[model samples]
Target: MPAFALEAEQRKWCEELRTLAARELRPLADAGEEGRINRELLAALGELGLLGRLFAPDGRPASALDLCLLRESLAYSCTEAETALALQGLGAGPVALAGTDGQRARWLTEVTAGRAVAAFALSEPGAGSDAAALALDAEPDGKGAGHGWRLTGSKTWISNAPHADVFTVFARTVKGAGSRGVTAFLVPAGRPGLGGEPLEMLSPHPVGTVTFDGVPVTRDDLLGEVDGGFGVAMRTLNLFRPSVGAFATGMAQAALDAAVEHAGTRRAFGGTLRDLQSVSHQLAETATRVEAARLLVYAAAAAYDRGEPDIPRRAAMAKLLATETAQQAVDAAVQIHGAAALQRGHLLEHLYREVRAPRIYEGASEVQRSIIAKELYS
Candidate 1:
């Protein structure tokens, strides 16, 4: 498949996703509270078979391109639904990659069914972008080799926290080893010494702090090899990065569409906003940028699917361009719409809140640039 254009069936699927998001998912999103898990919406995604698509029954995982398309289509109309779906994939992905058969048989099915909520607990108050700087300690139990470890420390800015049924937690197991010291544990919420509380945030998702006092995790709970959690995290990030760009592109496209419609109809100085060269020019520029960002996202996903080298550079470029373009497109859309766009319930207002976080999460824009530069020099 070409990076610039999707196949006919793919395009049709995207259209259907957009319609489903608008007609079915949007209402569920509206009925749910902000900064909390929406089980209903998640269940709906499962019922529609969207969540199940994240992992394949044939043991072949879904391609990065499929993830990109699913994310972009859902995001175009229902950012909340898109976020929920993405979070599920992020939280449960490590299990699919390196879990034991029993683990996979247990939690994965629940996750795909949306019966169990999952959270990826990686970032902490002191280590948001520097994942290797993680401070969460996984102290070995002196009981013996199979005795397991006790987790101690806190993970902040975690999505679906305080409510998720399970968490893929990264903790410093070999301290002072930088990225090499970490270990990934599949921690269940009902375990002793595990606790969390939600935090109010600018974006409309559940973000919070999860604390571990002496959270006991046996070897059975380990996702990957001990002291190899960083690689698992990176692998998960690599897969999801381009899909993040797809999400941003979806928002940009939505913003551009809104701007174009407003410019074509709303009366201005002497005529419609489209008659003014400044408004028309801004819309045109934004449209071009959005298309460029979308193409970059597609190209990156294609590279990942094809197992191409230099994926880090392309993924970073795609995320950087698409997220930045989304911010610009949203800001332009708001400007064209004037104060009406700022109205609390306006689509642009929702998108305005939605657009800023992508540049920070997954990987910040600065982080992406650093990744791109490092890959270039290497």
Candidate 2:
């Protein structure tokens, strides 16, 4: 690889992934319910060894660059599969990062095998992007539960909630501690007071609110030390942030490709749409922005893999640029395709819906800007 460009093998692998997503994964995604977990699709990813790649073949974690490539390639042809794969990583990532051997042996195996689902339960209704402001209380259990704590509160907008077999939950273990008081726990779905309800959203993924009515967890269930959960969450997000950009870049590339093809072939006033200076110019700009976003994503991912200190800033820049560019590219595609793009089942329509949420989730665009600004001064 020439510093910024992908190596030949990497490019070949990405092409293969795109083809596999289109041919093997798309059908499973098409058959799944709009807002439900697609177990079949997940299973297909596992069977193809995509899920296992979340961790490396040597039991060590995979590189951030590998994650970006996988996500981008999958998103290029099948956003649903990309989302499913990403969620698996997001929800179970902490375990691979800080979990005990027992926890890894139990959940990570099932997770990678597609037999067990996992969720990262960090965002509460009151704490969306303000992670440190979370108020889920973790009071000590006094019912002879032996070093256990009782978690009481609710988490909203959690991906794969109400259905995940396990959750890496964050809660406030000490009052007045801000981020310092938070703790991470691995709580199974069937815990005594654990329950959840699915929420309908604009994007087609399983998101919901989980209510913890004094859910019990022991020290054995803790992920990392008490009050160390915030670090765990941040580490996971730092690694994933650039890959989120990769996801957006893939979507943008797809939209740009569609727009270019349409402009080249779709008839308009006396000639093909490409002959129109207005249409061609818009495409030229969109293509440039998309490529720039992809390069930024690659750089950020590479920085993360290199264990550089400025990862936060790079990740934020990559995500902010790529996601914003994806929205623009999709909108431009829809505009070029005109009303036909708005029709049901149109590729542009699906992308139009899919493109809006990345801007909001996993730390919104506004939040990304804040991080970048803070990091610059620090």
Candidate 2 regions with alpha-carbon error over 4 angstroms: 143-146
Q: How many residue pairs collide in each prediction?
A: 0, 0
- TM-score between candidate 1 and the true structure: 0.98
Q: Give all TM-scores, in the order shown.
A: 0.98, 0.98
Per residue, candidate 2 scores C-alpha lDDT tens digits across 37-85 of: 9999999999999999898644446789999999999999999999999
Q: Identify the leading candidate in terms of lDDT.
A: 2
Candidate 1 segments exceeding 4 Å error: 1-4, 58-60
lDDT of 1 by residue, 191-302 (tens): 9999999999999998899999999999999988999999999988888899999999999999899989988999878899999999989998999998999899999998
lDDT of 1 at 119: 93
Candidate 1 clash figure, as a count: 0
Per-model C-alpha RMSD: 1.3, 1.6
